[model samples]
Target: MPEYITLTIDGARIRVIEGTSVLDAALDHGICIPHLCHMRGVPDIGVCRLCLVEVVENGRSKITTSCTLGAKEGMVIRAHTEKILKLRRNVAELLVAEAPNSRAIQDIAVRCGVTEVRYPFHHANCVLCGRCVRVCSEVWQSKVLGFVGRGKDRHVALPFNERPEYCKRCWSCIDVCPMTITPCDGPMKEGEEYLCGKCASQLTMIENSPDSCVWCRLGEGFQCSRWRP
Candidate 1:
């Protein structure tokens, strides 16, 4: 069993495992912290900066990413404060201006109470979070996608803007992307290629007479097992 650590989040006492992040601990304790680019079962990119919280330890206070900061004993965490809220709202506004077409970004802006973006719109939508790249390289182990440019022009894609052969087309990048950008297009099949991570078309063969479709054998409801010929 993993060792547990107790911490207070917004005046609520909660106990969590040693390795659990402050965001995870708060969620486990039913504490809602505004965040984006922090998905379950995915690496914490901490680029959104919306989950920033003020952590006071020994009277020293600092803002840090709750998604990446692990809960430690004797740590004082202030999840919601006027200063933090203002910072989050500003971040949301900037992100919205960058990705004006993104529904996710618009929703976040509304939630943060940001009605307009004050910065000049350049349309560089990519937030440089690296979630797409990390999901492709780290989780899928397919190094097909990467950052092609540097700084403001930084964006993830295939080398030389050309798709590589090693790409499995698993669409893991799409699954982890926080913005509207999709880095890779998967394999084509029957006039319907897998456009995103949630869908795929792969061949499957069954040796015995199964009363269901081969794809449905996994119990995912993709197809009925009774459709098997």
Candidate 2:
């Protein structure tokens, strides 16, 4: 039998199916929460910690990751209180510093109310959202990608960071990433790959092959017909 739960988010009464996450519930009810890592068909790891909400349970209120927290009957939730907005701003600030070059992150930071970044820019490549890792393991069943190390040095990598012969060459991770969606509006380099879903061009051009996008880390990763110069 199907189950349901009624909850209040920002004082709006809402009913959701059992197992529906608080983030998903708020989204279904037209509540927009700024988040970087929530993707359809991907297991919610809550690693981004951007979809946080204040939940009042049993006369106590605590901050929680909305994506991983299931909505329960009689629960009181607020997706964006002053406290939650402040917390999101803090997280976004760090992220902007970590990936200062990404337009997506820059725009998101503004949306999250982060006007300044206190940390120095690192120009990093990965935000370590674990979408690539999770897709490799859970979706593709190809456990080729994984996290190495821990803490400030932890990163997602293939075994030994080498392309294994068993790799199917699928780039499903690219599709789910919000960063690559509006990537590199600045310039293009020959013999280099570019992912630009916003400008409507997704390509990985070799110097020799100008017509084929046959190879991608995420095959059929992004949707676009506009090839830019």
Provide TM-scores for the models. Answer: 0.73, 0.76
Output the lDDT of residue 142, model 2.
87
Candidate achieving the largest lDDT: 2
Top TM-score prediction, candidate number: 2
Model 2 agreement with the true structure over 54-138: per-residue lDDT tens digits: 9988788999898888888888987778889899988888877776545566555655656566776675678888877887778
- Model 1 segments more than 4 A misplaced: 181-229
Worst 10 residues of 1 by lDDT: 216-225
